[model samples]
Target chain A: MDWQIIVDSIPALLEGMGLTVQLTLISLVAGFFLAIPLGVMRLSSNVLLSSPVLGYVFFFRGTPLLVQIFLIYYGSGQFRPVLQEWGLWEFFREAYFCALLTLILNTAAYTTEIFRGGIQAVPHGEVEAARACGMSGFTLYRRIILPKALRLALPAYSNEVVFLFQSTSLVSIITLMDLTGVARVIVARTFDVYEIYITAGLMYLVVTYGILWVFRTVEFRLSGHLRDRALDPVEALKLHP
Target chain B: MFDLKGYGWMLWEGLSITIMVGFLSLLLAMAMGLIGAWGKLSRNKAANLTATTYTTVIRGIPELLLLLIIFYGTPTLIQNTAERMGFDIRLDFNPFIAGILTLGFIYGAFATEVFRGAFLAIPKGQGEAAYAMGMSRMLAFRRILLPQMWRFALPGLGNVWMVLIKATALVSVIGLEELMRKSYIAMGAIKLPFTLFFAAAMMYLAITAVSMLGQRYIERWANRGIRRA
Candidate 1:
């Protein structure tokens, strides 16, 4: 292993880390917000609203993220004329924004399914009780359903977060200088593909482990209510029965 | 618009390669998964530790990264060693081998969890009962355990298979001539990337849907002997 080269590449790697962190954070935040409405839309009784969301999720989830990134990046370039006519080409022209948009959209589809599962897992009695208490529609959802569903969704959502962080590496192919991209550049320069890739692998490992740790901690904290409930025999019997 | 003239044949050829790669690698992945799961479940501490380490490192790294490392790094290492050993045979690493190995490495990690969980889900009494009935350890496992493990792990394995199908696209990064790579080439030749990619996406969806239906059939077959009442 070239220890000196690895040490010297720290600053460059850190710069690459900025892109990785930025892409992962932006995508996760956007995906979370987008997931709520998308999830609801997928489960909606109305075919009009639900079909588009269904198609969107199917298209995004069925294909590989790398292909999606390529389609959004290189494919958009083919439509430069159409985008320019609408004065929207500027956003699609930049690799960074295009990569970010693809990641956000792709992750949103998966997260929406997670949220939908969580929502479906909510007991029907809770909704009926909320309605009986004069808390219907948005008010009921806001105060009761959403919270319970989110708690149930927390574990799967954390897995999505870890997946998104690992996925951010795909953006490197779209010309984004994320950690993987920087590693590719270093490999091209030094011709030490093994050492550079190993270093990059280590960097990604640290980030993934960090994400896993934080999510595990969050999962523990959020599920604490269940732990306490489990300790009470009466509550357990009531919930079970 | 679709580029029928340029991409029709290419997509067909790529589809064959994708199917070939997925099936071959699934075989390798299942073998690795079975071994890894058994190793982890073994009473031996060293076996468990080795299996756990493999899962951790492979799981943590991105599949694309692993593909790149294997595709590029392995050849140079092989060639250097070959030259040093005065070997006359020229060793050129095949992309199919590289793609299969990479997918196997990644899928093995996932299969480890699925198989281990499925094995644990088997009631302990079944194995014990079989053993007490004059069956040896291996006989007990073959007769009482493997069938149940398969049934329990079917859903998880299906999900992994779906992921494995999609992940075959990563092999295109190293110019494996898979669907994505073919689409990329067609896009360059025809200058119509959106249509080509959309076509590629539809092809992928078709493959996944068929596999899903196949999974349902297998599940039905597996559950046929069980009592529904």
Candidate 2:
């Protein structure tokens, strides 16, 4: 490994880190909101609303993120005339926005399912007791249901967040100069693929490790009220970015 | 507003290759997953560490990076090793093999967790009871452990299978004629990216729906005894 070359490229690579964090943070925030309604629909008794949501989750989860990105970026481009007429062309024209939209929708579909599991895991007795206390509708969901589901869902949600962070690298293909993109650009110039890639890999390791640390601290704080705490540092690292 | 007039045959061709790659890699991933699960669960510390590292590194590295490394770096590495050993061989990697290896490596990491969880779910006393009945270790594992583990692992394994099926699309970046690559070609040829890509997405949805049905049947079969009870 050429240590000097890696040292020289850090500034350029760090520039791409902005895009990486941007994609991850935006998608995570968007996906969390999107997942709530979609998750409720997935568990809904009504088939009309639920089925479409089910189909959406199936479609997104079943296809690769790369294909979805291609479909959104290239596929949307083919509909330029229609998009222009509808005044939506501006949104699709920006690769960064399109990539963000894809990641948001894709992660939302998966997180919806995860959250659905969490919602279902919420004990029925707790809901009934809350209802007996006269809570209903949004009040019921906001106070009684959402809090319990979040607690149940935190572990899986943490993993999803890490996966989303790692997945931001895919945006590089669509012309967003993320970390991976910068590394590739450096490789094309320097022709030293291994050193540059190792640098990128190490960068990911650091980011992922940081994510793992945050999750552990949060998990530890969350379990502070519980009787038995079983958060293993090593196991917690697996959930890191 | 959709035009499917001229690209019918080409779409079918692309779908076939996509299915081919997905199935081939599915088989390879399953085999690797089994071996990886064993390696992870073995008593040997080195085996456990190797499996853990393999899963962690492979999972952390983006699929595109792995494809790029194998495609560009593997050949160079092979050529250099050959030169140093006084061999006049210029080694070439098959794209299909590379695709399978990459997918297997990715899915094997997930399968290790599924299989480990399943093995842990099985009560240890069952294995002890089997041994007390004069059964060999292998036989005890085959009869007492494997069946129950499979049942417990089916749901998790199913999720991994779904993940692997989707991940196969990444292999198209390496110039493979899987559905995504084929759709790209058709889109390029006709200048209608939406139609071709939509058709490709539908094909993927069809495959996904079918596999889900397959998973349902496997789950049913695995739980047959429990259902009867």
Q: Which candidate is the best by TM-score?
A: 1
Tell me the number of clashing residue pairs for each predicted model: 0, 0
Worst 10 residues of 1 chain A by lDDT: A232-241
- The i-RMS of candidate 1 is 4.8
Question: How far off is residue B64 in model 1, in Å?
Answer: 0.9
- Report lDDT (Cα) of residue B190, candidate 1: 85
Docking class of 1: medium
Per-residue C-alpha lDDT of model 1 across residues B1-229, encoded as one tens digit per residue: 6655656789889989998999888888888888888988999999999988888788777887888888888876777678779975555668888899999888988888788888988999998899889999889878889878999778778888888999999888887999989988887788788888878888898998898899999999888888887
In terms of DockQ, the best-performing candidate is: 1
Q: What is the C-alpha RMSD of each candidate to the true structure, in Å?
A: 4.2, 2.6
- Enumerate the candidates' DockQ scores in order: 0.53, 0.50
lDDT at residue B9 of model 1 (Cα atoms)? 88
lDDT, candidate 1, A147-177, per-residue tens: 9999888767767887788888888777789
* Location of the lowest summed lDDT over 10 successive residues in candidate 2 chain B: B1-10
